[model samples]
Target chain A: MNTKELVEQIYKKKSFLCIGLDVDLNKVPKHLLKLDDPIFEFNKAIIDATQHLAVAYKPNIAFYEAYGIKGWKSLEKTITYLNTNYPEVFTIADAKRGDIGNTSTMYAKAFFEDLQFDSITVAPYMGKDSVEPFLSFEDKHTILLALTSNQGAFDFQTKKIEGKELYKNVIEISKSYHNAQNLMYVVGATKAEYLSEIRGIIPDSFLLVPGVGAQGGNLQEVCKYGINDQVGLLINSSRGIIYASDAEDYAQAAANKALELQKQMEEILLFKK
Target chain B: MNTKELVEQIYKKKSFLCIGLDVDLNKVPKHLLKLDDPIFEFNKAIIDATQHLAVAYKPNIAFYEAYGIKGWKSLEKTITYLNTNYPEVFTIADAKRGDIGNTSTMYAKAFFEDLQFDSITVAPYMGKDSVEPFLSFEDKHTILLALTSNQGAFDFQTKKIEGKELYKNVIEISKSYHNAQNLMYVVGATKAEYLSEIRGIIPDSFLLVPGVGAQGGNLQEVCKYGINDQVGLLINSSRGIIYASDAEDYAQAAANKALELQKQMEEILLFKK
Candidate 1:
């Protein structure tokens, strides 16, 4: 899906919430464990329950990869299901993959062509050549890691390079990449104070913010500085929503949690209007 | 495998030559393409032919991940083959993966536990929390990307951070991680001039050096500054070794190419002695 369509969906659903499918079997409901593919089942249930309250589903690739071939199978099934059942809801691979030029091309093919994710998160440490391969793909988005939500983001990202923060350098440099219009960015909601400055660098680009609720990032603070005229912010909630309740009503419980966030997003959008 | 064991294997084999199994179907021999699992078959042939010459095998994960499920299956079979048959040889999953603390644990599990690689390459952009989890794994090495072989390395890696290069800061900061002993680093052969300074920082840590032949890195030049008492370098040549020929003699051709590098490595070890 294109940026225009994503914005359309956000307005249509009255939400810019992106549910994170970082499914770990240990955390899922005990009853779902008996199923043939528990991971896919859990994701299916969550998507069904909260698809309306969200415009995107971001799957943390590490969770699926930890399970090996079985995990890859589940991932394939999940992507296929999302594309077939609800194509309108954007899909983010959240793979955080980047490599040398040729190798990065292989990764782009894996996530964008084969798995068919609308976008995949990429690390910017390898610099231009490592990231540009993903940008070359028409219509497919590449969410570059500008300033992550994690504590580690301070390690190298916030450090000064040429008298400017590395994250800002990344945002500034990436704008010049080939077909850079397809570029989006991963900015942590935990660092909401940094958003206005980040917005100053790339005011129009979408930022997939992943830190709220469980990570102690306030939604109001994030929206206060994050949202643009097109509402270019995807506030992701994983553990706070998915693992809400492990009982049979786990899906409903997840929906309730999502409803709370969606209602707040709705109010924010209305107030902005 | 531990550092001691890896060093022992390097000395015993008289070659720290790391064969990169970056098997792209388009580049492989036509005959192998007829096989059910061409990727695995190609890898097995190459491993069988060069097992005695090379001390380690580094399969670039992006190559496998490109093929999706079947590719993962091929990777599984190839690794299983390497472990079972050539148990003495060290394995490196050139995945170049890193994430937040919890997610890093999942990636460490995927490569170290699930994939059972002796070492896995990780990107250091996220800093301490993103990398320490990989270090926590006993006997499993975390090869951090310090200076990559690609041109993009010059983009941010060489940039001064607080009057010191970011790559140097990465090496310095990573040393203070949880289990610093388990940390190796990826210092590309293309950047041989940076080796002495890198060696000054982490003399004992193993450096997986790619860009030997295909990317125009000199093994002799690399050995002059990069080698330690244990000959702390795994010189990787992917296309120059693996894709030596696309005819029926592909395996033999690959072995011949690996032997040339192995011979060069042997000379380096002998000269060092």
Candidate 2:
């Protein structure tokens, strides 16, 4: 989906929430094991439960890839399910993938063409050519990692580069690339305070914020600095919602958790008005 | 394979060449398309013909992943073929992957456990936690990108941070990780001059040097600054070797190309002797 459509979905749903589909086999309910593809079955239930409450659904590709061929098939099934059932909802392959120009084109084709995700998260370490291939796809978003929520973010991302933070430099420099308008940034919600400075760098660009629910990021604080006029934020919650309950009522429990977030988002939007 | 075993293989073959199996369907011989799995068939031919000339096989994962499910199946077949028929060869999955701690563990499982590759290339942007998980796997190698061969490497990699180049800092900091012994660095052959300084940081660690022929890197220069006591370098040549011809004699041509590199490397090792 394009930025305009993404923003439209947020306003229409009264939430900029993006549910993360990071399924782990050990954590899943025992009954799911009976199915031929438990991962897809689990994802289908969660997506169905939370579709109305979320504007986006991001399946972390690493989770599916761990299972090998079966895992890849599960991923295909999940993406197919999302596109077929909820055409209006945005999809992001939370696959932090990047390589050289030609190789990256192949990756762009894999995620954007074959698997058919509206967007995929990319690492900025490989620079412009690695990322530009994904951005070149018209209307498709290439979410670049900027100030991630992990402790490792401090290892190099937040370090000083000519007096400015490395991530700040990344955000500033990336804006000059060709088709820069199609670019979005992944700023972890755990560093909500950094969002204000990040906003100063790219005020108009959408940010896919992941760390709110399970990672101890406060929603109010993230919204305080992250939300733009277009509600330019996709707050993602994975384990907190999907694994809320592993019982038979797991889907209902997930819906309840999503509904709670949606209600808070509605209040946040109303307050902005 | 362990460092000892890898060194043994290099000496046993009198070559440390790692042939990259970056198969492109359009570039392959037309006759191969008539096969059931053209990509795998092409790779099998390349491996069978060139296995005696090279000590390692590095399949650039993006090439296969680009083809989606069928592509992944081809990857599985190629790896299985290599492991079954040529057990002595070291396999490197040139998939530059990295994510959060938990996510990276899944990737480690994917490449090391499921795919059973001896090594997999990982991008260092995410820092300690993202990489440590990969390093945690016993007897498996995590080849971290220190300085890439691409033009985009200058964008951020060569930039200074606190008076030290970012790539240099990456090499320095990563050495302090939990299982740093299992770590090897990827130093592009184009930057052969940097190898002396890189070698200074991790004297014993093996470096996977790409960009030899197709990218205009001088093999002699790379060997001059890169070779350690164990002859610590796995020089990769992809297009120059694999795409040597488009005729039915493509496999034989590929073997000839690999033989050329192997002879050059043999000369380099003989000089060391």
Q: Can you tell me the CAPRI class of model 1? A: high
The residue-by-residue lDDT of candidate 1 on B1-273, one tens digit each, is 887887898888888999999989999989888889999999999999999999899999999999999999999999999999988889999898888889989999998899899999999888899999998888889999999999988888999989999999999998888889898889888889999999999988889999999898999989999999988888888899888899989889999998888888888888889
In TM-score terms, candidate 1 sits at 0.99
- Candidate 2: stretches off by over 4 Å: none
lDDT of each: 0.92, 0.93
Predicted candidate 1 versus true structure: per-residue lDDT over A24-114, tens digit per residue = 9999999999999999999999999999999999999999999999999999999999999999999999898999999999999999999
- Residue range with the least summed lDDT across 10 consecutive positions in model 2 chain B: B150-159
Cand. 2 Cα-lDDT:
0.93
For model 2 the local lDDT of residue B26 reads 91
Provide DockQ values for all models, in the order shown.
0.84, 0.87
TM-score on B-chain, cand. 2: 0.99
Distance (Å) between predicted and true CA of B198, model 2? 0.7
